[model samples]
Target: MADDTEANRERGIFIMIYLDYAAHTPVCDEVLKSFEEAARDFTGNPNSPHTPGVMAKKRLEEATENIAKILSAKKEEIIYTSGASESNNLAIKGIAKSYQRYGKHIITSFLEHASVTGPVAALKNEGYEVDFVNINKDGSVDLEHLKELLRDDTILVSIACVDSEIGAIQPIDKIYELVKTKPHCFFHVDATQAVGKIPVSFQNMDLMTLSGHKIYGITGIGVLLKKEQIMLEPLIHGGLSTTSFRSGTPALALCVSLESALAYTTGHLEEFYDKVREKNLLLRRALEKNKNIVINTPEDGSPFILNLSLKGVNTNALQAALDEKGICVATKSACCAVNTVSKPVYAMTKDKKLSLATLRISLSHMTTAEEIERFLDVFLEAIKG
Candidate 1:
């Protein structure tokens, strides 16, 4: 794929129109500038006690404060990590170990990303009882099922705020209300697909996960927002750092870029939402006309992602066909194993064949009408028998 893309660039004809924004976003110039500026200006370890070190620590603190202010959390509540995957792990595993004496039960749904599911699976192998909350036909968490699943022994309920593959928005507020009834239970939300695209409040969560690349910031930086009262077993326990929950040298540049990207995204969320809605609508109108295509994303799902399945058609072949036309998308989550059915789609549609043939076309505020039209043209051609 890399070689083909490079060859295409060398030929200097078609520039790829990317529609995989759910998996990753291109770092914007402004965010990249912030990263470069931070690297140059803060040339000392935040943990160091000297003059340059103090300056670096101050800058990183300011960045944390900025992000906390956006999340409606205190500065001390934010713990930086490698990315959302680590945050998910820390939340699931850390909470499992820290509070296991109270209870050893965990609840999650099939709609979660690989990162969330991976940790939960690991816990199950370690003698912790794990339960999966049923998802509704729309792919959102089934509240009644979740209610039945929660128990006094349920120490944690981890769920994604939004389904990555099909974009189903979970009712976080209601879920919080349910989780809080259990005194020992902690609610962890993977908001990696939610924060920059829509409005979310950390006030209702015990632990929350989000990453930079999803919002056009530099990759490899993310945060785990922990309520100040919670105690987490440290994921990385080697050195002194911002929070004892994870210990590592801060990626100061990545932190700065994350703050910049988040600030810009939250500030213009409405505008971004409206723009992506129109693009999603365009894709929906065009694709729904094709008898071979079945839209998997619910009507009320996030407008940034539009998932559809090609009936009786091999999605991998379709993806390759679109690639030939210089367009980019995903068969599922970018990290998902290739040639496998989309779990989220199957949860929503309950159709194995449709799930097997699913394709994800994620949009962004940067996506233009021209790109959508071109993609539809190529897509229609590819699906032609």
Candidate 2:
């Protein structure tokens, strides 16, 4: 009876410790309030010509301007989309389709999220030549090889600002300088894992992708920042809307939520980052002493994510063990978690053993010191048992 009660306790009633912020974050209170208010007040279609529509349009424009200001971009540059996947698809495929006359070759890193990878692959199938940039053992982009890969015919170069698997922050500034050597080449960044958690600049970026859910906003909204000079072929075609590139009715509630989330995140970014950085350091210091664990995240990368490979411990089993104790972690991107294969870490390092044992522990400003402590205690016991 005592054992039964203990087992039930292990699997029940405990407050869950959510450590998967990179996968997606819960909508914060501020963003939720804005969404609720928008739903109640802005009920008209933004494109309609009636007074209610005009009011909705005004509010929508304000949200767009707010997001642009936070990112240091022009209001006209922001293109709203369903999420990062759509934004990535539009940016990659749109550029390839529109600029084929200038060039047919494109470049990207092997460490990109599947959203970026899938669109690039589709482009390859459509007869465009694609080049993948390799990463160093530490997961940083190989700048020398990238320099060699550039040519007069290279039309676009896409790289992730922050890699999701290993949390390696790419040197976008240096990459921008290199890609500029080819006058016709445009640069795009899949910044799903970078924005809000770290400082991002659009000075050198021709196109960049952002997702609202990743920043504690609604799940269905995303933003693509495109330079006014860059031309993109329309991915969706229908009735004319505010922009010709993507044709669809925009969700006003989602826009309001995304704008509010960004305002909250960027307004106190330094404070939020500093707190998470301290937690990251605490976790690293605690695990570094264990000879059986290998830490893969770069020391200078974003502090919100940590990657580890545990020797002699099955990663799938450990994840399950932690989940049973009301702690949530991940073995890969949430989108690819169920697959038995691990690609990103293995491709970056070519270490099969490390990849199979990989675990991703992501933090957020909402994470508490007590949660971290509890995680370490539960994790160590699971590994030992």
Top model by TM-score, which number?
1
Estimated TM-score for each candidate: 0.97, 0.95
Best by lDDT: 1
* Residue 362 lDDT (model 2): 98
TM-score of 2: 0.95
The lDDT of each candidate is: 0.91, 0.89
Per residue, candidate 2 scores C-alpha lDDT tens digits across 73-187 of: 9988988899999999999999999989989999998788889889899989989999988888777889999999999999999999998878989999999999999979999
Q: How many pairs collide in each candidate, listed in order? A: 0, 0
- Give the per-residue lDDT digits (tens) of candidate 1, residues 232-342: 998889988888888889888899999999998999999999999999999999888888899988888999999999998898988887777678999999889988889
lDDT at residue 152 of model 2 (Cα atoms): 96
Give every collision pair in model 1: none
